[model samples]
Target: MLLNLNKMNDVKKTFDTINKIVADWDPLGVGETIAEDEYAGYIPEIIQVMKNDQSLFEYLSQILANELGRGFDSTDMKHVEGLKSICDKIIRAYMDI
Candidate 1:
């Protein structure tokens, strides 16, 4: 449809503008390419965390505890406080902070 094409073109232009801006404005060139081992090591934990119904931090902590041979109760207040720290770390890592 003509309307669909126009909408697509508008979106394409917007994306082009954004790309140009980012190309001009990157402050950090970027970090080291993530190593395969690093990613592989986190795979199981990331998957378990994704599968959890609890908050992401609590979920990640639980996964870590399991990996470290410790029993952690996600519902406990101490773990919940730990979850807050985990949350900060996660958000910071993703630049969502």
Candidate 2:
């Protein structure tokens, strides 16, 4: 139906926005030199957190610690806070749709 198609389009839009957020966050400092999908691997996990109403910051912290072999320290407080805000922003964006 047309309604379903419209909803799917909205979902895709949200996904694309989230994808850019992850890449723009650029935790690896690759900047625009990397492909747009460079952070695509994290998209599903971010979506999962949004769907489950879970804490993205916690999930991201786990990923950084286990997958990246790096963890935020006191000196990285700003980056940590930015991640937290991104979590809130994602949830709001998804719910608003």
Candidate 3:
């Protein structure tokens, strides 16, 4: 019972981290809106990855980083790196779960 509770807590924390990353990347919000349709596709994919299997988390993270990088100015390495950092955090949190 205690172990189950701890696992649940970990899942919740992981979800919260994922949510933060998604919100940060929301096209309608502060995030860039370059590839609006493509960006829309990512949320569902993220949720699917969250459900289907954990082994694919790294792939999802890389795809997200690539999509985010494409949305920003090509010369903006700082912004691209920041987005990649967010992806890294999401991947780390997912792994923790």
Candidate 4:
């Protein structure tokens, strides 16, 4: 159990470091944050997550629409899935390092 806590802490530190670099989709150009090429690779899988969970999709859509001034159009559903895939993969990949 103690080891698991330590492992989680390491993951959180990694997440923080990555966030400091990416800074919410804006490249800080410093850390090992998710880049365009990396994001592209994960899109398909993330889309599957969003498709399987309606609440997650709605939450993401609302955030984009209200916070980012990004409105969903005909392509948004597909785009959301892609983005979700990319982000999920990034999160999973970063959890270890």
lDDT of all predictions, in order shown?
A: 0.46, 0.74, 0.56, 0.50
Evaluate candidate 3 by giving its C-alpha RMSD to the native, one decimal.
Answer: 7.2
The better candidate by TM-score, 2 or 3, is 2
> Which window of ten consecutive residues has the lowest lDDT sum in model 2?
66-75
Q: Higher-TM-score candidate among 1 and 3?
A: 3
lDDT of model number 1 = 0.46
Task: Tell how far residue 39 is off in model 2, in angstroms.
Answer: 1.0
Task: Encode model 4's per-residue lDDT on 7-88: one tens digit a residue.
Answer: 8897557545444433445422323444534333323433334434454456445545665566655376787675565456
Among all windows of 10 consecutive residues in model 3, the one with the lowest summed lDDT is 52-61
lDDT of 3 by residue, 1-97 (tens): 9999998897567655566666656634555444344354455456556543343445454664565443444357875566556556656667766
Error of 1 at 57 (Å): 2.8
**Whole-model alpha-carbon lDDT for candidate 2:** 0.74
Q: In model 4, which runs have C-alpha deviations exceeding 4 angstroms?
A: 1-14, 17-24, 27-57, 74-78, 94-97
lDDT of 2 at 87: 77
TM-score of 2: 0.74
Return whichever of 1 and 4 wins on TM-score: 4
- lDDT value for model 3: 0.56
lDDT for 33 (candidate 1): 42
lDDT, residue 12, candidate 1: 51
